[model samples]
Target: MEFIILVASSFTKLLDPVVLAYVIAGFIIGTIFSAIPGLTATLALALLLPLTYSLDVTIALMACASIYMAGMCGGSITATTINIPGAPSSMMTALDGYPLQKQGKGALALGHAAIGSMAGGAIGAMLLIGLAPFIAEASLLVQTTGKFSLLAFAMVVIVIAQRGKVIKAAMAACIGLMLATIGLDAMEPVTRFTFGFSSLTAGIDLMPVIIGTFAISEILMQAGAAKEDRKMTEAMSAVKIRRRDFIPPLSSIREIGLACYIKSSLIGYSVGTLPGAGGSMGSFLAYVETVRTSPNPESYGKGNPKGIAASESANNAVCGGALVPMLTFGIPGDPITAIMLGVLVINGIQPGPQLMAGQADLIAPVLASLLFSAVVLIPLTLFLLGPYFIKIVSIRKDILYGSIALLAVVGSYVATYSTFQMMMALVLGVLAYYMRKNDFPVVTMLLGFILGPNLEEFLRRSLALSNGNPMTFFTSLDSLFFVILTLVFVYFLAIKKPLQKPTGAAQSA
Candidate 1:
């Protein structure tokens, strides 16, 4: 009874007209960013950070949070309309989404992605309401030892969770980690890999690196091929969502929905909370986990709605999940969060333990923004934006790819107007292309780059706290459990699984 009242009261606060308008504006901006290739949520937020400096924290957080949430969903527009994925996290969506679009089910695919995102966002917000206090309480107890162990566990899982050649994944991860080491040492002012280039002192901005690696590289690889028309041939029946198709059967929804929601939410939250692991990791990990556990795992690469649900929902959930740590600890979970950090600091709201305690009103509006933004996005995406999505497919592939390539270079240079940034983009693009040819998962490499700094920082901090004693890394119960879990995961992924590889039909059976 008390919980219900509290929730109802919170709901009432979100109904403010001014708050609702800002939330809607944020969604529109975010969706626009998602529609453009190479324009990521992180970059979008960073660009807006300075503008938010004079605004109140509530408005600032709302603007940033809304963009982060909608950006994850907006990627599906390009993923479905064209073969290109607007976000790396939407790559799997491209596999089936584009195929469905080619079959003239573009509206259906868009509908599914949008609806799945809404469901995921709603559930994630619910979880936030229920679990924030609990998670925050637990996070407060995480000392340096526990933080390092948890980070280590995340790295181990990232490598082991990758499908295909584990060695290649490990190699990619190492490369990313090395790239992360290019910046100055966290504890010391000494540079590690800058090579005396003044521009390299801050290391490479993660936004440009990722944009170049994924978006630019993708375009360059495909630019040689002539554009083929992928426009939908059959006319969409109607904009209506059929009652039968509106929701899965109760039993099916109960079974698959629970699996999708829980797995996606947990994976989404875990990855989102981790310093470097972002929406891409969250969605990819959820999709992978879904495949690993599904009875019809073979259906994943196809247009399986379950796979779409898992990926879409997980990525969307990451929006709110990411905010928990950022708001509470002042530590950005991923690239977008780092940008959000900039926004918060610009707004004169220093995020940390005192944020929630001292500024509950500001926090409430941000939370309100998450719930309301989705509500606004759904109608806008379904009705006003539906035709625009279809229109994107009409653009020639040559033009699309060319523009993306140019943007990748421009965005890279804008991050730091240095020739080295462009060179790094080209080099990484070539490496990524070769790596892709060999079936090495580039996403894992991205993850390693993202997590590398945090892992190093945490490890060093843990060691320093214990006077250089390695045992300090496992002083807490959470740290101990994660260490054991890491070892067990490694054994299965690296060793035991290889021993079970199929020699013939015998293994298949």
Candidate 2:
């Protein structure tokens, strides 16, 4: 009953003009950031973090939550229209979405993506609200060893998921882990990778790496492509989309089916609840599962509406799922939530089990904002901005790429107010460009960088707790489960699955 009242009050708070205005503003800003290639929701949130220092805590939280939800949905807009995903999470969306655009079904693809995002976001929010307490309680059972094991499991799964590119993925992850060690040691005051620089002691910020690897690298790649082929303008102008074409047919809905949305959202929510497992992984896993279970699997990666639905639904759902660990355990599920954690700290609010007990008022409003944002996304994308989004693809390459490059540079520098960061971004951008050309998976590097510190800290802490006894990990049931799970994933993803290929071929022959 008390919970019911809190939820009701939370909804009422959304009616406040200040909160509503921020929510709307955040949604709009997030949409624009996510729609533009080389700009991401993470960059938007990072830029917005400093500004939050001057705002009311509740309003700030609401705005961040709204932006997170909107940004996840926004990525699909460009992914469908231009073949370039605005965010990493939408990479899977681009697989099917861009092909649909080539077929002049860009509007239909966007509509399906928006609808899927709405359903997934709503369902994920409900799950977050309902399961948070239980998940938090369960999380308490995990010790340092268990935590370390869990992060290891996530990393292993991510590496194995790259399939044929596993070696490159592993190398990229190793580079990220090495990069993460550049800052001060987690347990001691010693700075290992400073290399005699003041800025190095503070460590390489995630913002610069993120912007460099994704935004700057993307800009360089686009520039190179434009130089090689000047026909983009002619090609874009050939595809035409009408406002009336924006509405998805009922057949699409029926074909994708309600079950697929629910299943993909559940997958996203589950993945998001794990610390450091992010939306990109969630969406990729969900899309893979969708194709595996789909009766018409051949239709995937070929302008299939179900593919767009599955990818968008899973990625958007990750927003709510990601908050579970952040709110309940003070553990960020991804880089974006890590920034949100900073927001909480700046506002003198510590996130953990006690957050709900003592600060239900503030937490309630944030949760309400997530739900409201999801509800608003559908109408905003499909009705208000759908036609404009379709026209985005028709814009000249020079203007679009030029503007994005400027934004990426400005945004990276402003985050730290340091010229060093700008240089670092350019350096990483060049490195990423070469890596991309060589087929190395850059996303793995980012994931490794994000999770590496946590993994190292947890492992060191666990060993220290047990007096350096390696058996400590095996002693705990929770830790043992994850360690065993990691092995199973390796077997399925790296060994057994590969070994079965020749056997199957021989049998078929």
Candidate 3:
């Protein structure tokens, strides 16, 4: 009750009109960034990170939360209209959404997406707000040895989750860990891999790494795309969305049922809690479940709205689920939250078990903004802005990519006013471009970089406590739990083959 009161009190302080404006603007920006192909909310947050320095911490956090929520919702726009998923999370949405668009019900599909996003995001935010405090308390039981195992679990699970490309994922993660070891050593006063540059003492700043990896690499990727790939399809010119088309019919909602929305939301939220298991996974699992249970499964690819419901609801729900470990355990579930974590760190707040109780004032507004964005702004933005989406997504690539390149370089420089960092952004961007071109997963690498320092610190501390006895890890109950958990994940991810059940549109896929 006291914790609830503390959180509620935090909201009152954020009731300022200016703060609300920032949240609204941030959502709009996130939607725009995510609606365009090859862009994401992660990129929007990366661009805004430098600005967080000037903005109040509460306002910055609120903006980030809203942006993250909007990112999930915005991707459905392009998926329905252009048959292109603006964000990776919307891939499942495209399977049904594009077919609906071809049937001239594109606007209706988007409306279903809006409804699903609202329900999922609202439920997810509620879960996050209600459960984080308790989870934080439970997390305190794990000490140094357990912490090491947990991080190792995150790394191994993320790597194996790549399915067919596990080897590539592992290699990428190793590169990240190696990069993390470039700066001053964690325990000793010596550096490990500076390679003789004086400025390398502090190592690479996260802003440069993120900008180079996502923003700059995207620019490079887009630049090299075949001309035919960038052209608008004939179907995009055929459909026109109006204000009235944004309201979903009652019969269609009944067809999907409240149960479908609720179940999909739960799936997304659950998947979001796992490391490297992102929105795409949440939506994919939800969509798979929907197809498996539906009475007329074959109608899915032809133009069924239920698929849209499963995809949007599950992906949007991921917003709340991804935050659980980030706020309580300081571990990022995905790149968007990773950037949001940077926002918290940049504001001089350290995340962990004590963060919620100690910094309720700072955390509460972010949660409130997330819930508000999901429940209110999602439908509102879709309705007000739906008419113009087709036009907005049709902007020329040259202008769009050019502007992004300028922002990427400027953001890197603005972080510390160092030209070296700006140059480093390009260097790292080129490296990431080739890595992506070769099908390597950069996200695991980024996670590796983020988790490497802590993993090393905790491992060393645990070994010291046990007088260098490796058996102490297995002997400790908390550590043993994580070790066993990792093994289970390995069994499921690498060793165990899934039972293939084909139905509906998935039959062809």
TM-score of each: 0.67, 0.78, 0.96
Comparing candidate 1 with candidate 3, which one achieves the higher lDDT?
3
**lDDT digits (tens) for residues 273-303 of candidate 3:** 9889999888889998998899988877667
Clashing pairs in 3: none
Using lDDT as the measure, the top candidate is 3
RMSD of 3: 1.9
In candidate 1, the residue pairs with backbone N, CA or C atoms under 3 Å apart (3 or more residues apart, or in different chains) clash, namely: none
For model 1, what is the error of residue 289's alpha carbon versus the real structure, in angstroms, after optimal superposition? 11
Write the number of the candidate with greater TM-score, choosing between 2 and 3.
3
| Clash number by candidate, in order | 0, 0, 0
Query: 1-509 in candidate 1: lDDT tens per residue?
Result: 33323444655655777766666777776776676555566545644543464566667777777888888888877776665677776766666566666666666667667766777776666666566656555666766677677667766766665646767878988988898899788889899888878777888666555655566556655764445532332222222223233333456445456667667867876677654456777777777777778898766555666666787788888877877766665555665766666556545576655666566556666666676666556545556756655444345556755665666666556544666777777777777777776788676676677667878988887777778888864666767877987788678655674422112112211
**Residue 362 lDDT, candidate 2, scale 0-100:** 80
lDDT (Cα, 0-100) at 34 in candidate 2 = 81
Question: Against the correct fold, how does model 3 do in TM-score?
Answer: 0.96
lDDT of 2 by residue, 93-189 (tens): 8888888888878888888888889988988987887776566667667777898887788788767867789899899889888989997898899
**Model 3: lowest-lDDT 10 consecutive positions:** 500-509
